[model samples]
Target chain A: MDKLLLLGDEALAQGALDAGLSGAYGYPGTPSTEIFEYVQHSKEAARRNVHRTWSANEKTAMEEALGMSYTGKRALVTMKHVGLNVAADPFMNSGITGANGGLIVAVADDPSMHSSQNEQDSRHYGRFALVPVFEPSNQQEAYNMTFDAFALSEKYKTPVIMRLVTRLSHSRAGIVRTKYLNENEIKLPDNPNQFMLLPAFARVKYKNLIEKQELLEKESENSKYNEYHDGKDRSLGIITCGLGYNYVKENHVESKCEYPILKICQYPLPRKLIQKIIDECDEILVVEDGMPVIEEWLRGYLDNCLKIKGRMDGTLPRCGELDPAKLRTALGLEPYPIKEVPTIVKGRPPELCKGCPHRDTYYALNEAMKEYGPGHVFSDIGCYTLGFLPPFNAINSCVDMGASISMAVGAADAGLFPSIAVIGDSTFGHSGMTPLLDAVNSKANIVAFILDNGIVAMTGMQDSAVTGRVEDICMGIGVEKEHIHVINPLKGHHEENVKIIKNEINYNGVSVIIPRRPCIHIAAKLRKQK
Target chain B: MKKNIILAGVGGQGILSIATIIGYAVVKVDIYLKQAEAHGMSQRGGAVESHLRISDKEIHSDLVPHGRSDMIISLEPMESLRYFPYLKPDGWLITNITPFVNIPNYPEMKHLLKEIKAHKNSIAIDGDAIAKEIGSPRSMNMVILGASAPFLGIPFNMLEDSIRAVFGRKGEDIVQKNLDALNRGRDFAEEYIKK
Candidate 1:
């Protein structure tokens, strides 16, 4: 096959294809969303009828992947790091239950809270699941590992996690070509006892899981994934994992006469590899992305005697992703001469696209809230959350999906005047409606802004649950027909919409604002059709 | 031979597209390849980074460590600087001179330009200008990608094929525009060397 350009997510999808995966399951989330989207959209996948769909959420996605693997098919499940929290229950159990087929779960972690609620590392989840985790530093690894992970999963009869961070999930890289169209064998579980979780069965499985730890450790020992290069000089050794290694190697700042490197990609911590590198060098600098799991592990295993240094010891900061310059400084190399940068361009701070329905909705909201004296809006995660930024600044808080309506109700219960919740069509379906029902039943004086962009725009516009049933769902939730205000967001109806909103704000009960508009991105995309 | 290349940029900058095209081009050359990218928060105006590893032999790991990359290609200047630590001492940096201001701190950006100019082994091109000259500023990504192609061992024709594959039916106009931008970038680099 010829080389093809692939998104980090698409490359992972291709990697899964190369890895002989039979299926993939996931819900859309930025950074991690594209993998499933690609799997769903790829011509090769479609022709082969590979089982790819956006599962309702991460939990279902994981279980479905598990189901496919239970039938002895290779499966890949992916989600953003936070989505793993939603699927953590099954993820933990999959280890104890074991796998009948090859299973790879790719979780893309977001550090620095880019499009996520928190910068949490998903590797911790893999550690918790007691499964081997593979973190690829670049696109080629992303592809190769997706394929390699399946084999490892089936060989070990345990699900493997391929963890990626934002940098590694979305970045592009040059990768050499190999054969394609590989698909895994489909097999069925011979013993129902393997998946059954009754105490008798689960207890035995748990013990097996415990015993598998040693097997996993042993696998890590001779595993080709755990490798080291014997530097001619072994004074100051570098041990790096994932993209952090790329950052280190890019500078070639490794000490010529001092540093040997132990590059760890497979986990359960390859203790032998770490020990060998540590013993060969006077000082060990551990570089890994996100948290210092490796550093902390090395510190504990070496009893802090190895002069092990990394993020935990203030040699590196506890937060933010790292770059090569920082690694150079850590390696005691001269800094690259700083280049004269042109003045950074100050472009428009991103907001909802102009003429977007959310913009009109917020305009009406800001107008109606003049009497309320501001600080009344609660928002949820969507493109509309850009309402919190200036020009709009209409939203007060946006913590997570489905948080807006409930947060608004809480504010109203706490005696805040004219409380308003701004949520999108998809978020309302994800978790927003129950709070609206709660507010209606409790007679809370809150207005919920249901900005219907007709899709889940924040995560690349996957289908929204309420796309067709918004009205019935709202009505069923007890929102009064009279108070359900529907208005086009881009139309010049802010004054009338403001009047309706003010009327609802004074209603002393729950009100629903259905600001309907197409997302500009989606709209433009659709318009190109005409 | 093992080569590590890093690509860095802000979200929505088309850096990933450039990287993907390059990844495809490299594979067309029949080398063992491992690559990964960072996204997620990137869609929210955050920085994005990607790592590319090309080898002649089978690869066990997908990641490349610090100080080992042969080159750094940045679609934006500050983003390139952000990944500066990854570049080898003799490594090449290919970046567009286009600027993005309002990073979290360093309110006075005029002074930041001085810092960028002081860097060594940096090849900065007015990719935005080239894109505008060829067509859209969005094509700046392709221009910067074109500037780095020769040094990265990717042929322009291979990249064009990848572009066509990705863009599908839209490949005709997009490929032509991007090709123009790329040629302009290559010409600029050639002219800079002469100077």
Candidate 2:
């Protein structure tokens, strides 16, 4: 077998493609974005006619994958940890409905809030949904687990969640290719009411799901990924999960730790292996990536006879990702001397690109809003979010994907005159359109600026849904044709754009001002291609 | 043998490309390689770093431990000193003397170079100038990679082969220019060491 250097996300993508994945659906997000991008660019996937397309959002992506599973085709849907929150309704119910074919929900988590609003753990979602979870420690394991995730999903008739954190997802390592599996044939469920999920069927399905827990735990206990290594010393036991195992092994380079170790990659606690370590060692230490999930479970309400040390006891820091340095401190190893950064080194925060249209848009918008006030503009996510930093301190708020429009509407309702909302074209399609319709219905006095960059622009320039059609969508949504204005956002047009913005701001009804330009990065890439 | 390196530069400065080229070369020889990259938000002109670990045996952590990095191969002088804490006391610092002054408060270039040169084991070269002199300004990353090639524990020919493989798709002209840039950088470093 040939080996290929691949990121953990790429390995998962290749593994799933080799495992007969029929469709890969996802929205562009950091860490998880490369999974879908890999499939989209794979010649093998294109040759095999595999479905690869970006969904409107995570919720739609999840539902579409479920639909594919219903048709007896293996499906893979990916999203970041927070994206699971948007798809929670379908995700939580998918376990009850069960699956006719294998389904893998791959969620990449950011432990230290890198490129995310929060560092929420995805393992909790796996537990909440009562679905088996696979958290691979390395690229090879990520590939192997994804190849096996489908079988596990089909065997248990449930959607499996493969949880990956930023370090594992973004890092690259060599992985040997595995034997490919053919695509699944279209086969319907034997039970007619399997997916109905009516009140009558819900009870029976819920009961069946509960009954399957014991078998799931049995699978976890016997899983090859969950290994219990015996050691001579029994003073302290170590339970490492996912990347935590790597940090632990990194500390013990020349020799293995004397403590009995239970390395967990499969979920459902793997109670038997955990108990074996607890019984052998006097004290247990739980090391996990995101939260103290297993640690909290091991230290339930009742006090145990054996002393347990983990995030709770401050043996490890309760928050942030685990690193080799942090693990060494936790294990009572000698600390390395810290080097101090020179005072001359200034902070270099991310800023708008040199030729970014957002800079021009912000400059014009700031000029327009000078008379009104500083706190009137609400922004949304994207490259334009960088406008909140440095010289162009233009935006007042940036909460979630499409909060700008809705927040502006709420403020307008509370009598804030000339409430301004700024959003990107991609974000408007993701979650901004419905709120714009709400403002139209309520006749709120707000000016929504859709920064039409003709691409996603933030997550490496994926196609924007609202590109070339922002005006049609706004007009169809009942915004008066006269109120919707499109202006070029450039240095030459700054004064004109500011004038147009001020005009829209003075309008009483819902008005949308679109400053249209292709993202400078995408423009440069296109020029290179040319 | 293990080589733990920190590749640092401002975002879009092509440090990841150097990592990729080394990664391709390392895997061809059946060596274990793990590279942890900075992606997403931090990539928009902010300072970025990647931890590249190559070992004959399996690697444990994707990240290199604090003060355990064998070398810091940087594309910018200021970015090179940023990861001083991660470099072992004996570790080499190979950096391009050019400054990527994206921020308004970027320190004076002479002062930055002085701070970098204060280190006991440091090699600062004008990689962009060398690449431009070789008729390919975009090969600055290749120049830095070549300058650090001696310290990488891999053979120079292997690094050249990796460069050929990575840029093979860009045509022979590109591959030849980058190879020229690499050799120029290697010559500069060898001369500096002899001095």
Candidate 3:
């Protein structure tokens, strides 16, 4: 009964380990990256022979996990919400293929775009995939539901989606030790018909999925994961799901009689539970972290569901993670005001570190583009995006993982002045290679900046494709040997680096500017370990 | 009664290790437990927070409310103040009073200790000095965490166990040093804190 202090993401990984998962595959993304990283580092997980690795990207990760599940081994795929978009091809198709083992897809949504490009809800993906989705209300439930999700996956022959928001993924809570199950044997499909995805087979599987919807709803209605806590308050009924439910229950723990509550952790729109809340209370308030999917459904299900109020009704903001203050306001509790202070924490936005190599590289790029004017820089995702802050403010665009190179090419072809693309080593591998190839073949005038930090730097220094060899990749992408410039991004030689950037910017053909330096954090970690 | 407290800070500031010590030690007096942390983007010096919700009864909500937290333990002054809306008016705030230069806004930083000192029951400790005295500035978060121990109602040995649990695997020498840092902060708080 020893308690281990766990991050919400780590707890989910440990929960998968405790639940007897055979393997975990994922691509690193904010809020969800630690799930696989923790699994990779855990002695218990390793002792049980759990397979853990960072896949090429989210799609490869999802497919690899699906392949493991096909062999009748419990496999968990972890990814940030947009990672679901990358994996959507395999995700939407997996429902038709079906799973042999317990397959759980844990999607961590970053509402308010904290560290992500989008604040998408993966629950919609779950609904689209026709798989039952499980959202934990807290860390313990994150553990329990992860364990239960594996069972549900096995029982229904469908991959279960476990959705987490930034609050749920990053938060910590006390979790009781549960019985651990270690299953190493792989159970292959008994019938080949399950793997065959011919149109006939897919149609049959699709129909089977349709028939299983009732079972999913039944499982949700009868789940130990989802519950109806009878409270004292019947007038202002509160129906909350996921972490939003936790906020409601804790703040109004004493007001049980006044507020009847239906707490949902598992999904497929538990209509029966919604009905119970509607029938019991005069005014119902539906609280959820993101989107009004359930609340929207309940309104139609039970004659507008007793004057429904929630995010849709402006009872809660339709965006961002929901906390107790927002919940308290929805329930008519006294609001807590933030103390008015003259000078609090300084509003200094994040920038490259003092000795960061990216700093000099960005400085060079900015100087080279002085004649080109602004909006000519298309940047990729990484620590280099911090260049958009103060002193530098060099990057004009940062859309997604590897949009910089392609966007820059299009802009250059459209006759933009000195269009340059700056992406990190990790991001270049993630999705930059294809665009770089396109630029090479089309003979575009865009200059691509590959900031090689020898690691993923932004997502905790995990390994990347170009981690060890950036020079070779640029050369392979058909950059002229003379134009493929590799320079250390340190201070005192910022002017020389800027001169190199100017030469490349002036080049009317494809060019690659390689800024070489170790990330400050990574260098320190290496030094400490040594 | 059980009170759930959340301590948040930037990565290199030792937030996780400090939370571990508090989690291990608090269990001895209260039915305390701490969850394992999984920070994805802490590598880029991103903001990180750990939830330590301890209570007399079992706690279901792992996250502390925006304004209902009993205490906000911070290693970096800015990180502590960033989550200031989460702290209750009557709650305690303990932070390291070091001035980290704002690199982008170079040569300019508004001091936080003066404003924090004027707030209710807030105490700023020389966590860096205590940690250095214990042979590591990396242990500064533990010092600030230790400053909140007595206020948290957790026994000394309980914290010692958490300290031991986290650093136990690293080495015995590190465990002793971090524990020393924790005690040094505790002693400083005991002598200087008015509340």
Query: After best superposition, candidate 1 residue B69: deviation in angstroms?
Result: 11
Q: List all candidate RMSDs to the true structure.
A: 5.0, 1.4, 3.0
Off by over 4 Å in 1: A176-188, A231-235, A253-257, A275-282, A300-306, A340-349, A440-443, A525-530, B1-27, B30-168, B171-195
List model 3 lDDT by residue over A390-416, tens digit each.
Answer: 789899898988899999989988998
Candidate 1: tens digits of C-alpha lDDT, residues B1-195: 677788877777887777667666666676766666654334545666777777776543344555566888888776776765566767888888777653444335444445455665668887888788766778898888778766776656777787777665675787678777777777776776667
The superposed Cα distance between candidate 3 and the true structure at residue A342, in angstroms, equals 3.9
Query: Which digits, one per residue and each the tens of the lDDT, describe model 1 over residues A142-181?
Result: 7877766777788878999888887667654455457564
- Winner on DockQ (1 vs 2): 2
Q: For model 1, what TM-score is found for chain B?
A: 0.89
Q: How high is the lDDT of residue B100 in model 3?
A: 56
Please give the C-alpha DockQ score of model 2: 0.81
Which segments of model 3 are wrong by more than 4 Å? Answer: A300-306, A336-338, A524-530, B4-11, B27-51, B76-84, B103-114, B130-135, B168-176, B193-195
Which is the leading candidate under TM-score? 2
Docking class of 2: high
Comparing 1 with 3 on DockQ, the higher-scoring candidate is 3
* Shift in Å, residue B126, candidate 2: 1.0
Q: Could you give candidate 2's per-residue lDDT for residues A120-189 as a string of tens digits?
A: 8989988898989999999999899987889999988999999999999999999998789999999987
Query: What TM-score would every model get versus the actual structure?
Result: 0.82, 0.98, 0.92
Candidate 3's residue-wise lDDT over B30-68, tens digit each?
474544343543434556667677776756555666677
Please tell me how candidate 1 rates in CAPRI terms: acceptable
**Candidate 2 error regions (>4 Å):** A301-306, A525-530
